[model samples]
Target: MRRLLRTTWANTVLLALVLSFVTTTAVFAKNLDVSLTELFPSDRQVKTTLVINKVLERFHYRRFQLTREFAAQTLDNYFEDLDINRLFFLERDVTRFISNAGQLHDQLQQGKVDIAFDIFRIYRMRVDSRIEYALALLDQPFNFSRDETYQFDRSKSAWPVNEQQLNDIWRKRVKNDFLTLRLAGKNDDEILKQLRKRYEGIMRRIHQFTVDDVYQTFVNAYIRTLEPHTAYMSPSTSENFDISMRLSLEGIGAVLGADNEYTVIQRTIPGGPARQSGQVRTGDSIVGVAQGLDGDMEDVVGWRLQDVVDKIRGPKGSVVRLQILPKAEGTASRRLREVTLVRKEIALEDQAAKSSIITIPTDAGAAQRIGVIEIPAFYRDFRAESEGNPDFRSTTRDVRQLVTQLKKQQVSGLVIDLRGNGGGSLTEATSLTGLFIRQGPVVQVKDAFGKIEVESDPDPDIIYDGPLAVIVDRNSASASEIFVGAIQDYGRGLIIGEPTFGKGTVQTLVDLNRYVPGDNTDLGRLRLTMAEFFRISGGSTQLKGVEPDIHFDLGIAGSDQGERSLENALPWSKISTASYTQHHSINNVQHLKARSAQRTAQESGFQMLMSRSRILSEIEAEDTVSLQEQIRRRESDQREQVLKEERHRFLRAQGIEPVDEDAESPDEEALEKQQKVIDKIQTRESAHILTDFIQMQWNTAYEQRTAK
Candidate 1:
């Protein structure tokens, strides 16, 4: 399953004081017919709030206090969560809310969430008004000749000072919407009809928001002030989370997150239907979903994220079709591409470790073969293992088999590719690290009470002692950081690629019902941060992450991405280093780094990768888009041309023919070929670097023998 972070279930019992809370409140019932305009905090929500505040304050790793200052921060986060673009609420509205921040701290202690509801009420009004205004604008024709620009990203912008200022912003936004459709070859009538439906759909969904939604949003805003990873899941959301963890749902295996009104694809799970389709990409928005091959496509624009997901999920072996708005086309583009997929159960075997070989030509007649193992996640079947299934699946067990097979192939070196791995089981991480080392500590865990526990390798065998390299990227996090950090600390392998995601903290899912025993009201769950991870070398991977010995310039700056970019993230710290023997395998790191740098500089493939990275970086840096039709079209074309030329170069370098830039999505075979070309560019270079190290070791041994 695709997850935001590594999580464990908390086994500790709730405090006696928390368990003593009176559960006399009427159980909140879900009623679709309830008026959203008069939303109020339920008695159950009040009780849940008190428990949440107590739990967070007493048990969270940060030990956060509900101070007046924190209350103000929560209010700010709540406002941003509701109106991120600064397009709805006025300056006076924000000021009015800010003035009451001082009193919010005390009110919250009494479980009075009236202020949250009050602000949301006004927010709903603003949303309704804005959508109404936008709908009206669709009837009017926009002048494409005007050289205007729309500031699409206004998260940091000041709120509109007055109604007139707000209207101007909305006017530009509506015009840009129209222009985007026009450029996509839609006629004026089509554009108008789509825009009207889209606007009305937005209003309709907002009106459908229930009391639970309001409470979840408000509580999470407060939770974020404590840490980014800690979150509150509503009862419904909790059920969905459970379904995901169990991997029981049959659907497109893609994680979805809301980006404003659009349901954006966060990632595709390995071995899932979405990944097998090869057409769905991260950042793409699902604008429409249909059941079966012949079902009518339902327009899902502006729908609730869960509702959209419900529309897409179905029984095993059933076919589902998705109308995707490609991320490369930007948000304004109306062009949609459809993909059909057969949903299937995402089994453990689907995500099993896979192995391959990369051959590098040496100066001598013989070529050097380097084995590459790609681990999508650190996974294990705990139930199967507990049941004494001798062949239970696990990352370490799978990799051990792969290593044995690779050795049979007589590969000179090995590479572990963990570029997009977001981590999994903690035990798997420790065991996986043990596969490369004899016996030593792998990682250190510090609990909320400052108790440090050293997680050591249980096995004493070194499975693969050959020249090794671990490739990581920004998405490599949690357990991934633990494994790579240990390898780097013990000098067992070379750490390559970008820095890992600096998520050193560990979270545990807490069942709220466990605290309030008498209440059968289904209070949902809390994912709370409870511990921090440190490398055996004493340095924490909290915010700094694990920096590679040989860095790959992938456009993203380390400081601007990963845990460092998150709000309220724990700072990097150090503990007493554990005693472990270093292999001294990477003694010639400087020489290896220089050689890799020199080779990559001259390599055409690396040059093209860097060029593509630069263009993407430039695009991400722009916060505004040109509203003028001619200028916008020219810019879009230029970007496409540059990217297309780079793709052609890459294809040629791989000895493959380049396809047309405007061509439809490629078939599964073509996608596999393209993926291979991408994999070679990164993995092949790492293989070459490892081969250099192997050759250097041979030369050093020869010189020493001669001297002796």
Candidate 2:
């Protein structure tokens, strides 16, 4: 609803019936093989199909089933779900839209070029029509004009609970969006007005795109049939994913969702106001907001979701309040809990590079250090690189510096952490792997055809020839897979962690502006999944992420952690082996694994995690939920309490004061315990295994080097 892709707001007036199916009179026969009445029983149905077809055709798509009956139902659903009845626009505007929508449907089915022009012309009319109205209210205080009071809950009260009242409810909604942007530092002065005018001018041309949206949507629908992830990126929405993954947006700490009024907290950023407060939940919905508590809470009904987000966002340290509506059942209304939050800068540290030290004891009671470097993503600021700056930020550059620092700490073994890294810059991923292995093809990319392009580490010298291991998780995707796979293919190091994040497709951002010439310069960008990355073994890293040699459970409470959890991801299948040669020795790795398996069986921490996983799975698999089931739930709570008590008893045995079990307030003691536990487990792993696996391998490699 809040079309943030910067397209002009058209208020979608003209798609009432699709004329693709004509009256059986045989007046039209240009690939029009069906009866309009059969496709659409009513004029409204016909218009909806027409709109659907126009948008579908743009993707140069093939195959679709839009029956007139389905079109009506779809429209009904869309309107109900979006609460279109609560629109703040004038009745005349809505009526015109309904009329135009029908005409457009006819033109679309007829395959008329005029249909394209109609899209532009009509969208221009709608945007131009509203510009003055929006301008009139731009400087005004937030006003709902309390025109009506209608209980909008249809299930509770059937029929129109005062249609005009519903309209008034939505009318107040759009104003809030304008205010949100202004609060986020956009002044409603003359300068911003000019900027908006320019941006909107460019946006309108993009919106009038008669062919592109339909084509892309069609492609997406088709792909959705196969799987969700394998689809065409509409040229207008390109680079959007890249922007999101990098954590570089300005404004509020919240992430945007499709629906205008609802939001899902992706990850609460650390050091931000939300994190500092620790009250705003990850899945909380921002039902309403106020500049402050005393400010009136406007009903954000029928508002574009992103517009609501814009309203809540502000400069760092600025106070804002969100009326949180958490997820709930239809029978139960989500509580409108008010939370006062402050705006602050947030960064994705979890996605950044990290390092760890695994202490392994040798036979002589001496401690050897194995430093682990975790590269979550291949990050680089190309904008910085192009400016002739040596300080151009990059993962490879950062890891190389980290290597120098790690060596200075006298570490004998190194673990490159690729677990949970979704990958970034192709260049950085390739170059980073070269730091470990002496150059070769890191990954082979194949396009639409069988043709493959092998991307190699364009370098031949190994950065660290010491005993090495690469720690990977199910989330190690794309370039992360390439790096880990290459290392394993050449037998350069040990691979640990679960299977990686199986995103192996290569996407190129296509700007719509390139196709549509002048006046549409700001047309959205598209990211087409153009190619798949293959390892030297000819097997594609599709649904399967890289598997670790020494696999360890992810220790997540109940969630799936790696390769198979993602939806619509490409399938994991292997092609015939490519002509390649193995280059390193894991002869000692098999031996270490035999020892590690035996040792891990005795570790209380490992056993605790495994047992906890079983209990967690049982909890997740339960489906019973009713008021009567509350007693059963209390029993389950008692079971959890028992587990907590046992854990506390164990902590007590270790001379650690177990955290309190009040469970209602913030768990400060629990957090402290968790940190300490993670520290104890990861730090003592080398000695716990009773074998200096990395060190033994390193010494073997060193002796091999010396023998040569």
lDDT of 1: 0.80
Estimate, for each residue in 552-660, the C-alpha lDDT of model 2 and write its tens digit: 7624431343346543456776666655567776776567777766766776665655555555454434432222223323444555555565566546656677654
- Best candidate (score: TM-score): 1
Per-residue lDDT over 292-352 for candidate 1, one digit per residue giving the tens place of the 0 to 100 score: 9899777686676666766776667888888887776565444567888887766778888
The stretch of ten residues in a row with the least summed lDDT in candidate 2 is 13-22
Q: Name the best candidate (by lDDT).
A: 1
Q: lDDT score, residue 32, model 1?
A: 51
TM agreement with the true structure for every prediction: 0.93, 0.59
Candidate 2 runs further than 4 Å off: 1-223, 230-248, 251-313, 319-343, 346-356, 512-525, 554-568, 575-581, 588-590, 632-636, 639-691, 695-708
lDDT (Cα) of model 2: 0.50
